[model samples]
Target chain A: MNYRIWEGKSGDSLNSENQKCTSRCGMTSSRPGMARRSFLRGTAAGIGGMAAMAAALSPLRELEAGAFNSVEEMLQKHYKEMTPDDMERALARIRRQVEQRYHVRPEIRDIKPVEGVEFAYALNLSRCIGCRKCVHACVAENNQSREPEIQYIRVLEMPRGTLNIEQGNHHYDRPTVPDDKHFYLPVQCHQCANPPCVKVCPVEATWKEPDGIVVVDYDWCIGCRYCEAACPYWARRFNFATPKIPKGALNPNMAYLSNRPRPRGVMEKCHFCLHRTRQGLMPACEEVCPTGARKFGNVLDPRSPVSEILRTKRVFVLKEDAGTLPRFFYYFDERYPRNTGGEAPTWTGPEEFPHG
Target chain B: MGMILAGLSAIMPNLDSSRQNEFDGAQPGLEELAHPHAEPVDPHIPGGALWAMVGFAALAFYFVSQPALPEMPLAATPVVQASEIAPGKRRDPIKEPPRIRVGAFTYGCNECHSLFLSAPERQGPLAQHTHIKLDHGLNARCFNCHDRFDREKLVLRDGSLIGYDQVPTLCSQCHGTTFRDWERGMHGKDLGSWDLSSPRHVRLECHECHDPHAPAYPPIVPLPAPNTMRMGTPVHLAHEHKPEAGNPLAPWWMHVAGGDGAAHGPGDAHEQTTHHTDGKTESAPSTHKEGGGQ
Candidate 1:
């Protein structure tokens, strides 16, 4: 049997009629312990009957049972090896799952990845208060794994006294904000001009898009986690476990720039809520900011608020001292008198964000 | 006969004086001696009574004028430090001037015309009714609002002048931004709506909605109703292509566009760009992560 034919035919080989049988066989191979018993529910008269009987009588059942030890290994394939057929199959499988998972059948399409559009991002950090609204928003926008261990927006709480964000951490479980000892400075993917993650990838699995967003081709990623390690901001996340977002919480509005619901064993990072931004709307984070701190706009447009702030404010990029040319920049209100002098500055630094 | 008459009158006067002296001797110093030093001819009055009457009149005048004296000293003292009195100083006593406190018989001239400690809410009574209301009625007299008393300046014999134009400064004591906004023409009712040529504009008093003392407004809340549906058509039907096999009736664009072809499957790809299948002809996809999300 030609393995290349199987690989080539992966996407489109199965029709709606054979989809269940093919998926069952596909799932059986990845599981070693499961009995390779393929359930053939169809009429025996079809497919010339003899081959069907041979397929039924032979050890194909046992072979099918052992097909999938892990669902991700069964579902995901390298993008380079993928053909029109492989993509069609993936689309079909996705549709089947969508119908099974949600009683509603959603039409699935094989999105041809776009080319040449260079993505860039600019964050008005001066406007960011550590609301953690972005964190929940990201989770909902991206159907990210809801496991407590996984978080897409790693909001780093940097206290007032410390300028060093590395020592600041998000793992402290006590509550949202620690106390008076700290003011929160949430740090996420800076989407650096020169990304260390891109350089470290063994496979060309991830590449920086024209718009300045670094996206991973999930099919190409081997889950080696080299990108996660190389990232200075610790922005990359490796999916070691299966993904599950409550059906009720799923954000139906999704876009490829923001990445669709990803299965396990692929690394994920902040895609800047691509689905909404690409559609000409503000990110959920910007929408939810009560203080109007997180401003987003086209940096190219001088009229845009983001560009205006850059032009007017004495803004400094994080670790600018390192020359990363981080798109995220923070500005301090120089006129703001420190509470140390007279009394505390009236702003208790957002009463809710008690964490450092 | 003549010698006998004279001797009888003289003897009679001598006999009366001797009797008076014998009566005074009984009480010694307590009794007045009938001598030439105490001689008074008129039984009714003395001519020196006019001088005594003048002295008594002067004493009575002083007692009557005591009420009119100013309680404070005639000279103005320094407010910060009384001893270091500055020249041209206004002797403004910090004390609660009458009618300035909870109650006063007559409204103080200064109340509504100037800024005062009697919070802005207290100013309303003196403004409309010429009388302080019952809640503010008992203690909050007229001077509570009209706090600029002209008594010291002696500007008004009756002290009825309410200093106009000084109203803004008084109103700005608390409704500062609103006053500033109104002054800058950013807010307030526009009187120059018809005549744009003139910059002249008038703003209503700050007391219109808010009492200056507790000057605040409800927090910002966007109109809670969901945004009106996009003003245009709800669904436009467009089918891009004719089918090859599956359902002859079902267009390829419907399958390609992913269900709901009525919503996305525009009939002509060239005319409508909503669901273009060709990536080349389709609008370029954005590279940047949609939101600057981390």
Candidate 2:
């Protein structure tokens, strides 16, 4: 394609147009009026030139949505860095977007953690039938994206004789659970005291609250996905596409640091249903469990259900050796927890769990 | 002197004015001086003032004659407590069997036991309640829970009778650990406010989940499973396969992709995951005895 016809030495002639362009650009041009005429002619093309430009840049925009929302999103201040007025504007912006897209006026509030209340969840593994009721309850209560099927809870089925999480199957399904030889262990975000996800976020989008719940500011998340990679439990989920939930299925009850409709290209995980929990109500997952396996309450209160579970039952945390200091605990009975009574029910310890 | 003068002046006016008005309007007589004989005024109260007095009297009479409010059933008792409640406010009753029925009918135990003498032993193989099947864990004996003397009440290890409302007491006789857990709001379902002080909170009794006759949870269906996040595609159940020996931590999608993991869900394979075809199969009593029943 190549002849150097438009090179510095190959100018054809100086024109009046070159003089005008040279004045505007402040470049010493021989044919200054030529450039100025072209600039006006380009303006004359109007949106047609824009169409041509868009077509030319279409390949790059396709790679990443470098369109309208990106520029403002990239300039957004970190959630923690934003002032109260900034937060109000951001929240209002989010509320408008949610209302426009979902046709629901979502109350996107920044719900504060209650003073003197630190929430903890306890699941009775012996009572848990691995029903997956808690899992779906979370999906409905939290505005989870239904298309990619983001669920907060994953009930793993372990072989009879193992506590090895690596050997557990998260996709366990059955008519009735407590599969004679198999037991279930459901995993979600642990809301750790020392969370790697919070530590790894380049932007301070996620952090641990005073109530011990780890939360993420949806607006501040830059979708770097470092948190997802850092978490050992696979707790964080990334939104690959703009999350498409039907307006009908949207849970209008939303909170800023927890389960509001997240923008595309952000990371989200469970926040222990902070919206409901902070309001003196049980979490949706705990309320829906049929076998009464899930228990949640304020840890500070001596009489709370979680306190009782922690005090009396033999409780263990997943990946205890990892030292995440999880607030979620799993307690099991001594094999025959239901029958610790009259007839001397025979059973052994954890070691006797039938190995696959 | 001033007082005497004032009294004499009042007397003089009556004497002088009465005589004057007598000649002005009255027929010329000293007897008519005080009465002014021309004007015949009626000695009655004015109509407007009388009507005002009547209205006031009627209003007072209506208020005085109004009926009193009826008495309430009980006067001002605190609603916060009962001798035996789960731990919170008394709410809608728990989901459980409504108390023991007699024979094949829905009659209460006291209806029949009130007449018959309490039996020391089982009545006979021909007993009416023989239709009943008890397959709870190990503590399966009838006398272990039910009172020998009072058929209507539950018996603790002690010879005392426990009312239906005190079922947790009857249950706590041997299951002390679970009772403690339940008291602290752990073991049982506390369908109430998390703020314990809030009203309408209730901890369901043990019988809500376990049938008294069959305490073991019956095999039932589960809620739907999570599919690919954001896509509404229902995950396909795995055709019969074995679970992979390792790689359990590899995320649910990895297990599903491997095809070996979906084998655990027996319901999904047969008769859509929603329906339970095998739930009715345990009607026969033989298959009930096991847990070795954990």
TM-score of each: 0.42, 0.63
Interface RMSD of each: 59.6, 39.1
What residue runs in model 2 are displaced by over 4 Å at the alpha carbon? A1-77, A336-356, B1-108, B118-132, B141-143, B229-294
Ten contiguous residues with the weakest lDDT in model 1 chain A: A35-44
lDDT of 1 by residue, B141-242 (tens): 334344333432212223334343344555554446546544543223222111122343223344442332233221232111101011111111112232
Q: Candidate 2's error at A26, in angstroms? A: 36
Q: Which ten residues in a row have the lowest lDDT in candidate 2 chain B?
A: B285-294
> Model 2, B195: alpha-carbon shift in Å?
3.9
The candidate that achieves the highest TM-score relative to the unseen native structure: 2
Model 2's DockQ score: 0.08
Model 2: per-residue Cα lDDT over A1-356, one tens digit each: 11112334324332333344335632222221222222222232333333334444444533433324644555668776778887787778778777767789988787888999998989888888787767776777787876655777777666656776654555444665556666778888888888988888887889999999998887777899999888777778888656666557688888888788877778899988899888877777777777777888888988888887798888988777777898989988765444322453422333221210
**Error in Å for residue A122 of model 1:** 5.3
